[model samples]
Target chain A: MDYKTVLTTCTYCGCGCNMYLEVMDGRITGTIPCKTSPINEGKLCIKGWNVHEFVQSPKRLTRPMLRKNGDLTEVTWDEALDFTASRIKSIKEKHGNDSIAFLTSAKVTNEENFLLQKFARAAVGTNNIDHCARL
Target chain B: MIEEIKKQVRELLTSGTIKGFLGLREIDGHIAPYLFCDAEDMDSMNLGDYKKPGDARYPLNRILIHLLSHYPDEILGVLVRGCDQRGLNGLYSLNQLDPEKVIPVGIPCPPELAEACECSRPYPENRAVDGQAEGYSNQTLARIAGLDIGKRFEYWMNEFARCIKCYGCRDICPMCICRECSLECGDLVGKGDIPPENPIFHLIRAVHMADRCVDCGLCAEACPADIPLRTLYKKVADIVKKEFDFQAGYQPDAKSPLNVLDQ
Candidate 1:
């Protein structure tokens, strides 16, 4: 049994909390906060503590899904991205750019969030942008 | 001190006294709880001192509980500090661990760690280190306890308000070892409520810790919201001490009165 703790940053939020992913036999079984971390100082939120649950979760989506006939159907990444881009373009053309709102998550990195807002404002020409962390 | 503990653990493993030595090891530059089965690899044994003494402490007794279930007949050697020994005592009282099945090699907390933790007892019964630090005073507890009822209510409410509904405090607690927990009950604690229904979520835990909190301060340290949870649990311990004349974690032979149904 190869048991070890891999020190890494929590991917839940922008908090950048350091945690140790307790790997048992090469599978992440638990999460423990890194005590020496200056950022969180060994403290973690509900999300950070349960970070390992998502990696091997049976409910986790391994493939992209698209709604067809009122049901989410598994689709290829290309198909999903193409459908999303086409829909966004059609919506922006039919209605004004302000009609659609782009919402981002705290789970994404600061750089990613910045790019998303930049895309919404410049590419989509809409000021209707918000973040999940606002709540 | 690290060498001293290693020497003891190495002796135990070489002598065939213990099947495995449960302690912390610095593997891959990360200090974590580990079970060393051979004396030759005892070089990686650590006393949980990374940046400071006792900084990388884990619930070894809690891990020991899992170890005992798998290896009931085999004798295991475990590392223990003051808090760990207390945890072992609590486990013993609950029959979660058998004293005869385990050999605990303990070390005393440095003065800085004791002062930082405000640990009442800074060493196990059999201490490997001498002239350790004295336990510090309770300034936070004192300040909160000094407040009147109205102010106290407001103070705790503000602190509890910062709750992200994280179960880190409960999850990190060594005393929390029930198969089922009241905090997780859907009816008692509603689902999808952030910050978890005001004081009820925290109150349930406090009531449960009335006779079990070992004053480890891990709960407070683990809280992302920085809630002074240890103060609340410590108050429960104080109440148990004052009202019941009982303290948990000091003696393994003595069962907590709260756990005893007959009273």
Candidate 2:
């Protein structure tokens, strides 16, 4: 019975279109293009209309997992981070630092992406950084 | 003209054959679709100006369908032009409507309104009451057919880019009956972008409209962007007819290309 529309910016791209996420009973139901948005001018592309579907999708990944006996098993964040660090360390030792590469996603926040690239260049010592949108 | 239709409605109401009628009523200079249950309220009906021309066939069709469904075995009369009559016929063929309990009072569009709609015909194939108007000239379709494919594509793309995805087209369409639309399908239409997966939404809708569109201009009128969506569907319908020799709403026996197996 808790129906409300939360005003937010579209996170799909850099355009930063304003929209309203219609929440029905605490569940994200749909998106409404903000009529007051200066950039979009009350129009939404097909994507903007369906922007709220993925947030409540059952298929979304929610936990860290490690491959165990050819199958992914749920693991603690500490274990996942330690495993990632050890693997990267081993890979750097085996191959040159320049061999490793990093890829960023547009879905993540700008601050998080900047930190990821910073870690990749400073810690992993590789400049081979790219993004999904590059392709 | 709406005044002429209202005059006819008064006759039908006085005949005691119909309990109510549906038509458009003028509201503060803008026209909205309305149902006229009383014969005394015919003064408010109007056929709008060219500057504010609108096709209320979709909403009127829905209102009629809803009324018939709610009150089965009741006789009701409605105002229909050629496009609205075709839409009603399409609905009847799909079994979405039962035409036996309804009386369609056909009101032929004047040359001016027909020209505005780019209409080829002004009278219904099946009319309960006769109307006074000649068939219209066909120029827009001919002009559209003269355009090159590349030019047509660009014209449609520009129009579609202005789409707000209001579902107004589907909402207004008499044939779009699916409770869940494919445009909301996860993989096909992406999420969180101002412009939907470029041209995919329009293309998908066109594909769906191939056998469904009855040349009603409701989609164009419902479109806030003023996209010529009905023209695209009209072209697609022509292609379907040329290839399959199947015309929608022509007859109840005629089968749609999408549903029937190719013989």
Candidate 1 Cα misplacement greater than 4 A, ranges: A68-70, A76-135, B27-30, B37-41, B70-75, B134-150, B190-194
Q: In terms of lDDT, which candidate is strongest?
A: 1
Per-residue lDDT of candidate 2, residues A1-115 (tens digit): 1334566777766677766675544778656555445665344555566689888899877989999999999999999999989988998999989878888887778898899
Best by DockQ: 1
RMSD of 1: 3.6
Each prediction's RMSD to truth: 3.6, 11.2
Per-residue lDDT, model 2, residue A30, is 57
lDDT (tens digit, per residue) of candidate 2 on B1-263? 45567778888888878877766665444344455667887888755332434432325676677667656777788777777787778888777788787788876666666777666666687654455456555466668778899997787789789877767677557778777999878788886665677698888998888887877676776566778887778778878888888767766556677887766
Model 1 agreement with the true structure over B35-147: per-residue lDDT tens digits: 78889889988888888878888777776776677567988989988888888888888888899998999898888899888778888888765656677777778888899
Candidate 2 local distance difference test against the native:
0.71
Ten-residue stretch with the least lDDT total in model 1 chain B: B128-137
Can you list the residue pairs that collide in candidate 1?
Answer: B111-B133
Q: Residue-pair clashes per candidate, as listed? A: 1, 5
